[model samples]
Target: MFALGCLALIVLPLLGFIAGLVMGGQGAGLWGAGIGLIAALLMSATAALALVKAGRKR
Candidate 1:
C-alpha cells in the first residue's frame, strides 16, 4: 500500500492532466488537477497510516 501510495502521488497528477487535456481542454484539465490532488492526499494519508501501524514494538 505504501509503495502504491508513493507511486500514485506522482502518477495521478500527470495522468489526470494528460487525460483531461486529451478528453477536453484547459478547463477539464483544471478539474482533473483538483481531483488528482484530492486523490493524492488520500493516498498519502494511507501511507502515513501504514507507517504508524508498522512501528516497532515498545
Candidate 2:
C-alpha cells in the first residue's frame, strides 16, 4: 500500500507526461497533470488510512 502510494505520487506524473507526449494535444498535458494530482492525493490518503489501520491492529 505504501509502495502503491509512492508509485502514485511519483510514477503517475511521469506516466502522464509520457502519455501527453504520445497523444500530443493541449488538453492531454492538462489531463495528465490532473490525473497525476488526483493520484497523488489518493496515494497520500490511502497511506494515511493504512497507517491508522496498522496502528489499530497493533
Candidate 3:
C-alpha cells in the first residue's frame, strides 16, 4: 500500500504530463494537473484512513 501510494504520488503526474503533451491541446496541461491532483487526494485519503484504522487498535 505504501508503495502504491508512493507510485501514485510520483509516477501518476509524470505519466499524465507526458500523455497530455502527446495529445496536444490548449487544456492538455490542465487535464494532466487535474489527474495528478485527484490521484494525490485519493492516495492521501487512503493513507489517512489506514493510519486512523491502525491507531484504533491500540
lDDT of 1 by residue, 1-58 (tens): 7878888888898788888888999888878877887898899998888789889546
Instruction: Enumerate residue pairs that collide in model 2.
Output: none
Instruction: Kindly list the per-residue Cα lDDT of model 3 for residues 1-58, writing each as its tens digit.
Output: 7677877887777777778877986379668867986887699789878978998995
TM-score of model 3 (CA atoms): 0.67
Q: Lowest summed-lDDT stretch of 10 residues in model 3? A: 25-34
My TM-score estimates for the predictions, one after another, are 0.75, 0.67, 0.67
Q: Give per-residue lDDT, candidate 1, residue 57.
A: 48
lDDT of 2 at 3: 75
Off by over 4 Å in 1: 1-3, 56-58
Worst 10 residues of 2 by lDDT: 21-30
Q: Which order, best to worst by TM-score?
A: 1, 3, 2
Clashes of 1: 0
Q: Residue by residue across 1-58, what tens digits does model 2's lDDT show?
A: 7777877878787778678767977578768867887888888898989899889984
Query: After TM-score superposition, what is the CA distance of residue 20 in candidate 3 from its true location, in Å?
Result: 0.8
The candidate with the higher lDDT, 1 or 3, is 1
- Shift of residue 45 alpha carbon in model 3, Å: 1.9
Q: lDDT for model 1, on a 0 to 1 scale?
A: 0.84
